[model samples]
Target chain A: MLSVHSVLPSLKANATSNNMTNKINHPELCQWLKSIAIDRDKQAFTQVFRFFAPKIQRIAQSKINSEALAAEVVQDTMSNVWRKAHLFDDSKGAATTWVYTIMRNVTFDLLRKMKANKEDNLSDDIWPLAELANTEEEVFTDHIQSRNLQGIIATLPENQQQVVKGFYFMEMSQEQLAVHLDLPLGTIKSRLRLALGKLKLKLGDPHD
Target chain B: MIKHHPKFELLQGFVDGDLPASLAAGIAIHNNMCASCQQKVSQLTEQVAEASFEQSFHHKIIVNDEENLTEIAEMDFDDMINQITASDDVEPTKAIYDERSIDFKGMQYTLPSALRNIELSKTAQIGKLSRARLNLGEGEIHTSLLHIGPGGSIPEHTHKGFELTLLLAGTFADAHGQYVAGDFIMLDKRDQHQPATEHGCLCYTVANDALHFTQGINKLLNPIGAFIY
Candidate 1:
């Protein structure tokens, strides 16, 4: 579904400024995104890259006013597009919207890092790509149905959400959670136990 | 049900990537809680994206009213593409639901997923009120997590710039009316109101300037306006 041009990549080198205004359309671009996600197709990634880079570059430079930083924004954003292509759900949004969201987030992170001189990036928390998974709006880093999460925490289908939280948000262990929460370890443990027991009851038998 | 929401302009700014991070994050949290706004946000995003890529949005700098349209670079595509595609490492996605909570004065309050990675200043207590600043680094524009204990009330005050209070949890009432969770209350310098919570509430607050305390005795306390904001 994702074909940037029937004219091929070599022809795109001579293609002028019209690249940004190129009518790749919605479903067609989404086909490229889907190809990249399912097959790790490099050519599809290249097509997507050609379509987005100039637009991202223009927007980034306009926002930051630095050529190098703007290039960094495009590179990082496109790299993320390649690496996390699987997260895009065509059902939830258009490919343009997805790329726009990513590009904007890259701008936010780069701007804050340069201006505030802080380490933590705020985009992940604010945009929260994965939080949409449990709901119907799952897109932009949606993961439950995407991959085997055994690398992080093995969880029950019912407990899937609780464990899923650990992946996207800041990593906080039970001890650190206790420290931040200002609760005794025993209290936290018992509270969890009680909550889980109640949840089990509310959900019907453990497996059912 | 969420009664008040961020104005359409703010939502547009959010989709346009023009808002301060603090304000944008506030809308995101609200969007998560309110289904109506969420739909609006997605629609806005689509419109913005279509304009950004397909239209003459490239011919204009949308930020300031500058005539500076950055010329798009026609750099080496093959090199950049080859470099990026070298990595076949498809990161195994470890993601699903988010349920991040914060601890305030020995009470565990669930935080909006938007605040999950935000850094908060230490809790500062004043009377029955407590606040933790969200360090978004937008100077002169302060954003905070304010907790009003049961029966506690904010002194009667008017805003000097603008104030946005998004009820994340619990309930609070002002001169206008009662606010439940998911309510977004935005007040400007012209508005004057006093807010108090009977059952207590935690609010995500944003203000560009200090407040102007009205009414009698609280006049001298106006200097602490910066603190309350």
Candidate 2:
């Protein structure tokens, strides 16, 4: 099993910084998360909030136009982090990736609420059941696979990478992406398909 | 054994969190029954999360709002912490149960985890066909749990908008094809069919509008189909 320290050496180097450090590094943030999970450490949580709140706010703002809504997403996401901290297994995935999943789910939930006339409850629907960690070995394997996926994505051609980023991260619809890039819809569709195919080949079977 | 599954595009949309709530619910229920699709969704989720993290690493930092930060800092953190910590005792709507099996007419039918806490509004029976509508409360989509008794059949009907059905148990056959447990069937306005079951079946169905009954005696039931659905 790979340790967090081994996976992220740069982040580990910053972990020894003084407790007064305002700009908490990734490893320290992850340690703080562990503290919250294990001991409900309020001080550690405070550091996490100070580091991630603004970053999450920016992510929400980019997807949602309303400042008020963006702030709400950030608050809600952080609140969930505090509440469900025990569920966060660092062996399964990086803290940033887990937080990113939460923010994306919240943004989508808010959008659905705005679009629908009926009040839909989506608390449990945010995370897929398959993603939940049931055992330590499973968590470790998933962490390694996710890390490999990041490397494969980074190695994709620039054009494919741009389309993948715009579609997945920016939440741009295919039509919106075609219009933004001044390309035909077919081109955008094919690029996304090809990019995903290459990633699948590199990552091997999903079950493995 | 389920043969048909949701297309890759739909599953991809689900992973990206771009699918509508109704469609997502359908896929969730399907994932509960199908291990293959579950693996696929899990893979897609990891890929999306990894990519999003990389993008965040390079994203430009936004200027902080000191006033807003101060307000958040001063809020009742203790109270908020208490509520979250105490949430375990007070169950949320989505309660995890050891077993989510429904008893109907002396038979136990196990349901997918997604359908565990949903309330069934009403049950209507006509001859061999019986159905219970699952109230998803005020959405454009209508979802229901339909049960067909032995040698029963539904009236020939056409969909008004989009209709997706995930068979939970037993076997059902339409003019299109036969569907078994874990089969995901999707139909739109362009398609029409009459469905029947020899062994009886249970299905989780979602539609944009009530089914349109198109043939003979069933056509007379069309006006009331909206009510039944």
Candidate 3:
């Protein structure tokens, strides 16, 4: 089992050169999540909430323009964590990644609902696709790969990193990013492709 | 087996949660049946999560914990949980697909999970080419299930906007290429083709705008196609 105690040394070693505002590591957060899952520990839940809620809220606010909708996204995301805590498997991924997945899905769900309402013709059932059946082993492998990615992404060139941040986190399209950065569209696309290529190399061939 | 899949850029948009619902749904349906695409999506989702974490940490957004805690404390967790769980119970599509299978031309074919709740409306039919529309809801793009029987052909037509067709069963071929089960075919305004099936085929099609029939004989279908599609 990957435990907080086991990963602390490595996390600290990696933190030395980085200017991180918060020092919470994946293992510590995962431990707290396990407590909530295994024991319904409110204290653990509270800790998880205090650490993740604001970060998620910020992400939601960035992607979604509406304050009310952003708040709703955070609420729904946390409640999902609270209710579905038992479904979490630490071996599958870091607690943050799992939580982020839930938040991302919830945000998209809300956006789809908003669009559906505006259209007034789409059935709500048509939007969210059926969840894929992910086996435990597959989840574990993805978790390891995902954890490794943080360090790899950190190692990317400064220019590639900036492009990746805008593309991935801000969810900007190539055209929008080109316009925002005042760069040619081809340059934006090439930068994104280069960044993705490096990440793909570090992560290994996804097909394998 | 499937050959062509959605481009990596489109799938990237999917994992980033940035694509429109219609396109996302289309990709989701393709991912459901294509393990290769599913694996790609999984990798992209992980990449997205990692990027999000790094970005969140770099910005020092979590430093204002006290204000957020108060915000959390003031909110009703119970009510929020209830609302989420209530939506969870509203699994209409799940139940429908579990309980029902589609019957077409005396043959039973399973509906893809993404398409389970869509209600197919019968449209025009000529010879072996029969079309039925599925209203994906208001403001959302329109989709349809096109059934071309053996030796059937759809009149040569050019797309007005983007059209994505996923072959669900059997095989079909247009000027571009032959398609089998799980094949995702994307056609745009510049492309025109006559699609025909030697062994009949079932396909899920999504169109941003109505198809523009181009052949002289099928030019007559322009008005009818506009009205039905």
Candidate 4:
């Protein structure tokens, strides 16, 4: 069995300096989200806030033209990140893409509320959380990137290992398995169940 | 099989979150059915998301560093983090089991999940064409759920503004060719087509101006003008 360190050799190299002009580490960010969701780690949330708060503010400011509204966007978006972190599946896409989706939806709903009297909150319905993962189909072409699955499964936290085995190796219904890899549904529910309800197994190697 | 799809520009607009609610909903409906478009939207989203963060971080390094940290970002990051992390309330995650359907001309058709929540006006019929307007309050733009009965045809017409017809079910044909369910037909002032169906079809439409009929004495009178646009 390959150690997690052996599998992800670049994990350490992907760390960000204080300025963060260097390419923000996508896997590292995913690890942070996983930590926030499973451990409710405040330090992880702070790191996320430091990275995203400014970007969201500038993006919101450019779209809406109001400082107060931009602040609200940051608050609401980050709040959602904290609450919905468990729903994020790193296999679907980068952490930046997932967070950006949240920010955009918040901006759209806010714009609608400002203009119209009735608020249907159309963004969530339009981009349903489950389907958002399918858009990153390139990554799900045929499950794990042409690798030794047994080697990598050993690297995951125990709970996540069960999920990978049940989803990929077990006999699951076609309805449960969606998309090319049969993910985003049965596996998503499993991930949620593992993270939120039953086992508190740390999903990723705890964020540094 | 679906033939028509939203153009590159429209899809880009959608991923960028720049389109109006009516238009955004249309694209979403299409994406639900079109696997290729769904992949495109996701890829586009990744590209946009990457640029959004990269540009912002790079900008911070240049000039907005101190001024943004001090003046622009008036909200305290630490305070916000503290408040957010205080709540252990996780969003309950469940797969949607929506059973939303709309009936037209005595036929019941399942509504797209995207339109499951938005309100639709009472069905209004003009001969074989039935339209129920979407309740979105976008000014100057009107969105509707339009049903065309079997043997129904929209009179040949031209438009002064934009019109989008996303076929949700059944088959339709214009002067160009045949369109099946999941087809996204977006037209501007320059385009003209008279769509008809041998088998009834349901469509989600968005338009800004009344169409100008091109044939018969009704041309000047604009007989079908108020009905569609």
TM-score of each: 0.74, 0.71, 0.74, 0.76
Residue-level lDDT of model 2, residues B83-136, one tens digit each, is 444443211324355766765445679767666656676678776766778765
Global lDDT scores for all candidate models: 0.70, 0.65, 0.64, 0.73
Give one digit per residue, the lDDT tens place, for model 4 in B134-197.
9898878988988999999888888999999999999899998999989888888998889999
DockQ score for model 1:
0.15
lDDT of 3 by residue, B1-229 (tens): 5777887667877776777656777788787676666766765566566556653243422322223322432345445544543443222333333644565666677777666655666656666766777765645367777777888877888867888888889998887778888888877898887888998988888788887888888898886455424
Per-residue C-alpha lDDT of model 4 across residues A91-169, encoded as one tens digit per residue: 8888888998999899989988998755888998877765676643343353332233354445566645544433322
Assess candidate 2 and give its lDDT. Answer: 0.65
TM-score of chain B of each: 0.90, 0.78, 0.77, 0.91
- Pairs that collide in candidate 3 are A121-B137, A121-B138, A122-B137, A122-B138
Angstrom error of the Cα, residue B197, model 4: value is 0.8
Root-mean-square deviation of every model: 17.9, 7.7, 7.2, 14.7
List each model's interface RMSD. 11.4, 8.1, 7.3, 11.6
Q: Best to worst by lDDT, what's the order?
A: 4, 1, 2, 3
Q: Model 3 over residues A95-159: C-alpha lDDT tens digits?
A: 76677667867887677667654333222233332243244234334553545444666677866
lDDT of 3 at B56: 29
Model 1 chain B poorest 10 in a row by lDDT: B56-65
Assess the local accuracy of residue B58 in candidate 2 as a C-alpha lDDT between 0 and 100: 20
Question: Highest DockQ, which number?
Answer: 3
Candidate 2 chain A worst ten-residue window by lDDT: A1-10
CAPRI verdict (incorrect, acceptable, medium, high) for model 2 = incorrect
The regions of model 1 sitting more than 4 angstroms off are: A1-22, A131-208, B55-67, B70-72, B96-99
lDDT of model 1 at residue A136? 46
Deviation from truth (RMSD, Å), model 3: 7.2
Candidate 3 vs candidate 4, lDDT winner: 4
